[model samples]
Target: MSDEKKLPLRTAFAVSVSKTAAALSRATGRGDGSVIGGRLGMMIDPDLLAHLAAGREIALVSGTNGKTTTTRFTAAALGVLGDVATNSFGANMPTGHTSALARAGATRYAVLEVDEHYLAQVIQATEPRVVALLNLSRDQLDRAKEVAMMADLWRQALAAHPKVHIVANADDPMVVYAAGAHPADEVTWFSAGQRWQDDSHVCPACGGHIQRGEAGGWACANGDLRRPSPQWTLLDGEVVAPDGVPHEVKLQLPGTVNLGNAATALAVAAKFGVNPIDAIPRLGSVASVAGRYAQVERDGRLVRLLLAKNPASWLEAFEMADVAPTLLAINARDPDGLDTSWLYDVDFSPLRGRQVLVSGDRAMDLAVRLEINGVPFTHVKTFADAVAAVPQGRLEVIANYTAFQDIRAELDRVL
Candidate 1:
C-alpha cells in the first residue's frame, strides 16, 4: 500500500478508513459500503484529480432515468476502439468509483453513468471531459429532491470544467435549454425523431411555450429547438450510423422507453467513437438488466420484470404492456418506489379491464391507490399470494427496485 502512489497524507488516511469500513461491512454481510461507490472516491478523489491534471479524458452520463442501459451501451460502443470503463452495474458513487478504478486501471478512456445528484459532486472532484445530459423526468422523488433541483445542480457541475460537452435530449425542454447558453460544438441535441414523445411540456429553461414538430421533437418559439444536425440522433427506435448501418438494437423486454434508453446510449456511445451499428445485435442478448426490464421465464410461463421505480417509468411501463396482459405491481421500501405521490400523477384507466396483483412492504398503499383509481387489482401481503392470485397468462411483473427482487424470487417458484 505504501508504494501504491505518492498520495497525500489526508488521502492515504481516508483510503485506510474506507478500506476498514468496507471490510467491516463485508464481514458482517451488511454491505460492501459501495452501493453508489462514493466512499472510495472520498479517498481516491486526489488520484482521479491527478489523472485529470495529467491530461487524461473522461466521458460521463447522468440523468434521472435510463442510466444503466445507457452506461452499458456507452461502454460497449466505446470498447470497440479501446478498453473502456463504466458504472454499467449501478456503481456510480465514490466506493463504486473504487471498483471502477480497479477495472479502469490506466485504460486511458472512460464512459461512466452516474446518479444525477452525485454527478456534480464527482464531476467537481474528477473534472471529466464530456458530460452527457440525457434528460430529466420526475423520478425517485423520495431521494433525488426534484427534477428542477437536479438541473440547477447540473449548472454548477458545468462551471467546474473548462471543457464540457453536453449531449442533450432535444425532446426534453429542460435538457435543450441547458444547451442554449453553451457553444454549438459543446452542445449537441439528441432525439428519437418520432419514436418517443416526452410527456413534459413547457420550457424548463425559459418559461416560454414549447411546440412539438412533425417528428415528435420539441422547440421554443424563440428558436430554442432541437438542432437538426446532431453528433448523434435517437432516431427510429435505435441508433444508426449516417451511412445507415442500423446499429439495429433489439431490446425484448418491451416498451418504447427501452428504445428511448437505447437511443440515449447510442448518442453518448457514438460520441466516444463506438460503432452503434455494430452493437445493435447485442442489445437483445442482454435479457435482463437485473430487474430493470429484466426478463425471466419458468414453468412454461414468462415473467417480464419491469422495475417501475417512479410514476414516469410506471406510466411508461403500463403503456408498454401488450395483448391485454395480467400485471403485478409492488411497492417496496427502496427510495426508488417511495413517495407514492406519483401514483396520482398517472392515469390508471388503461388498467381498468386488466387484472393487477399488488404486493410489497407497502402493497396495501399501492392497492389502495389502484382501488381509488378503479383499476382492477387484488392486494396480497406475501409474494406467494400475489403469484397465486394472477392467472398464468403473459404476466408482467412491474415492481419497485426491492420488490422486483422479491417478486423475482417467487418467479423462480411459479413462473
Candidate 2:
C-alpha cells in the first residue's frame, strides 16, 4: 500500500473501538439500523466532511435485491471519474460505511449498499449524493412487517431526504412511486425498456393491475410509466458480444433478474450524465457480486452461490439455474437471520429434474417443501454434511444472507 493510502494506527484503533462497542450494543435483542449504522455516523456525520473537496462523493444503494450489485456498479462507474472508496463486503449501514471511510484514509467518493429498513437512518447520517432504490420484494417476513408495509416505510424515508439525487427502478411501481415523490434535490428514473421486470406483486401506488407481459417482464396496465425505455440496456449475446465476458448472453451475472440489475446500474450512471457505452466497459470488469450469484471455481467444479433468503430471491435463483444437474442449499443462522416462512411461497417445480441437497438450520424445512414439490434429493443435514456429498460438476447452492458466511466458510474449508 502507498504511504498516502496508509491510515494512522491510532485513528484506526479508535474507529475499531467505536465499532466494537456499537456491535456489542446490538448483540442482544432485535437490532435495528439504530446501532449498526449509528456507529459510523458518530465518525463522520455531516461536519467531518466539510473541508474535504477532492470532489468527495458518497453514493447509497438500497433495496431488497441488487443493492450490492448496484453499489458495486455505481462505485465502479464512479471509479472511472476519480478515486473511489466502497464497502463491497456488505457493511453498508452508517457505522460500517464509516469504518470503510476511516480505512480508506482519503478518497474522492464512497459507494455503499444500505439495507432497506435502515435507509432513513443511513441517509440521515451519511448524506450521500445519490441514492439508488432497487426493486423491493417480500423479504424477512419475521422481522419486516410486510412487503407493502415496508414499501410505505421506504416511501416515507426517501421523502424525508431533500438534497440527495435519487435513481429508481421505474418498472417497479413501489420504487417509482418513492422516486417520483422523493423530496430529493433531483431524481431520475431508469428502466430496462420493459424487460426483466419482477412486478408480479402489482402496483403499490394505484390499485391498478400489473401483468407479466408477453416478453415476461412486468408491466402495469395503467398509464403509470416506466423510465421511458432505459437509454442503456444490456445487449443480449453469449457473454462475449454485448461487451466481452464469454457466455450465451451479455451477462456478467446470471438470471434476467440480474440483467435488470445490470440495466439499472447502467441507467443510474446514464442518468448521472455518464455515457452508457463508457460505463458499459466497467460492468464487464465486475461480474460476480458476493452472495448474489457469485460463481466461484473450486478445483474444476463450478459452485454458484445463490443468495436467496427472500421469496423473490429464491424465485430468481431457481430461474437462473435452468435446472442444473445438482443443487445444494444452506440456511444457517448468523449475522441476524430470521425464521424461514417465505420458503413455502417459492415455486420449485422447474427443479424436478435436478438432484438436490438442502442444509442449514432450516434444511429440513426446505427439504420437506422440496419433497412435496417432487424435487428428488440427496441427503445432507448441514452445510458441512452437504460438502461431503456434493457431486463434482456444475452445482448450485442457495443460502440466506446470514448463512452466507457459515456456508461459504465451510465450502472454503472442505470443497
Candidate 3:
C-alpha cells in the first residue's frame, strides 16, 4: 500500500480515469457509476483500496442482510464526530471501496458496508476501528458461500484482527461463532431480534441444534455455543442500553427490521462516542436509504419502493406489505444473484387475499411462487405496466436487487 499523499503515477492515473468513467456513466444514465468506476479503478491498481484508505479510520459493517441500511445509519451517526466516507449506494466490493475512498478526498473516517466474503481483504487493507457483525443467514445459496462457510471465514478473519473492536448481534448463533474469537471485553454484543431463525438453528461450533429459550436467549444442545449477554437490546421497538435505560427509536423507515438496523447502528455509534440520545434523532432523519422505503408518485399512484434480495430480507419486506394493491418484482441479474430459487423459501401466503401485481424479468417466476402459495397474482411485462395497473391509492412496490433500482429510477423520472 503506497502512501496516498504520494500515490504512484499509475495509481493516480487510474483514479482519474475511474472518476471520469463514473461521471460518464451517470451522464449517460447507465447507472450510479459507483460500481463501474470502482471496477475500472481496481483493475488498473490492484491495491487501489489500500492506497486510498491510507491514514483513515474505518468502521466496516458486514452481514447477510441490512448491511446497506446499517452502513448508511452508522455513517450518518459518525457524522457527529466528523465527515465520513462511505459507499452510499450499497456497493460492498473492492471496486466500490476504491471508488468511495477515491472520491472522498481527505475524509478521516470511512464507514463501509462490506460483503461477507470480502471482509478479510477490506479489513486487512483499511484496518477498521470497529467491525459490526449483523445476523448471518443463507443468502443466494447458488452464488454465495454457505452460512457455515461464511461464519468460518469471519471467525478466521476476526481472529487475526484481534485489535479491532467488534459490535456483534448476540441473538444470532452464526454471528456469535464468528465474533467468538475476540475476547469478551473487546466485543460489544447487541440483541437485534432475529425473526428468521430457520437458517441459524444449528450451532456453528458442534453442529448441534441451537435451542432458543426465554428473553431472547439461545444455547446449543452440545454446550458449545450460547448467546452472550448483550450490551444493547431491542426490546419492544425500544433500544435498551447496557445501563438498562431504554431509548425510544423512531425511524422514517418501516418495520421492526429497521428498528433492529437502527439498534446495531446506534451500538456502533456509541462505541465511536456518539450520544445515543442525540444519535436516535439523527437515525430518524434517514427516511429512505437508496430507495429501500421511498414513496414516489407516478401517474397519480403512490408507490412505496421496498427491496428484498434474499429470503430473510423478503420475510421482512413481506411483513411490511400490509397495504393493498402490491407490486412484487424479482430479478436474477448479477447484482440480484443468478439463482431465483430462493423465492420458494419466502412465505408469500400472507399476500393470499390481496391484489398482487408482479413485474420484472423474472415476473413469471414470482407469479408461479404466488400461485403455489394460493395468492392470486398478475404478471405484468414491465414495471411501468405494473405501476399503471394500480389505478389508485398507495401501491406497495416490493422488488429484488436490480428490479428495485429500475423501478426507483423510473419513478424518479416521473415524480
TM-score list, all predictions: 0.82, 0.77, 0.94
Q: lDDT of each model, Cα atoms only?
A: 0.63, 0.63, 0.87
Best by lDDT: 3
Model 2 — which ten-residue stretch has the worst lDDT?
45-54
Residue-wise lDDT of candidate 1 within 1-415, one digit each (tens)?
4665666565545545555665666678664455423455454554643342234466778876677766776666666667776655576764576545443446767777777777777676556777777767777666666666667677666755647777776666666555556666776566643322343465556656777766555576666544445544545565654465555567765676777667666666666666666656555666555456655554434656676676666676776676444555555466554577766776777778777777777777777788899887776677556555666656677777777766666665222
TM-score leader: 3
Runs of candidate 1 exceeding 4 Å displacement: 1-5, 8-33, 36-57, 159-162, 193-200, 221-231, 234-238, 242-247, 298-300, 332-334, 408-415
Question: RMSD to native for every prediction?
Answer: 4.3, 7.0, 2.2
- Residue-wise C-alpha lDDT for candidate 2, range 300-400, written one tens digit per residue: 55777777767767767777774665445546364434566666677777778776776666677878888888888776766545544656677777777
Regions of candidate 3 where Cα sits further than 4 Å from its true position? 1-13, 413-415
Residue by residue across 1-415, what tens digits does model 3's lDDT show?
4576655776798899889999998899987788898889888888788888888888999999999999999998888889999999888988888888887877989999999999999999888899999989988787789999899999999999889999999989999999997988889999878878888888889999999999888999999999998988877779998889999988888888888888899889888888889788889899888777888777888788888888888889887765678988888998788888888888988777778998898888887888788888888888788877877878898888888878877777322
Q: For candidate 2, list the clashing residue pairs, or say none.
A: 37-94, 40-95, 237-249, 238-247, 238-248, 238-249, 239-246, 239-247, 239-249
- Weakest lDDT window of 10 consecutive positions for candidate 3: 406-415
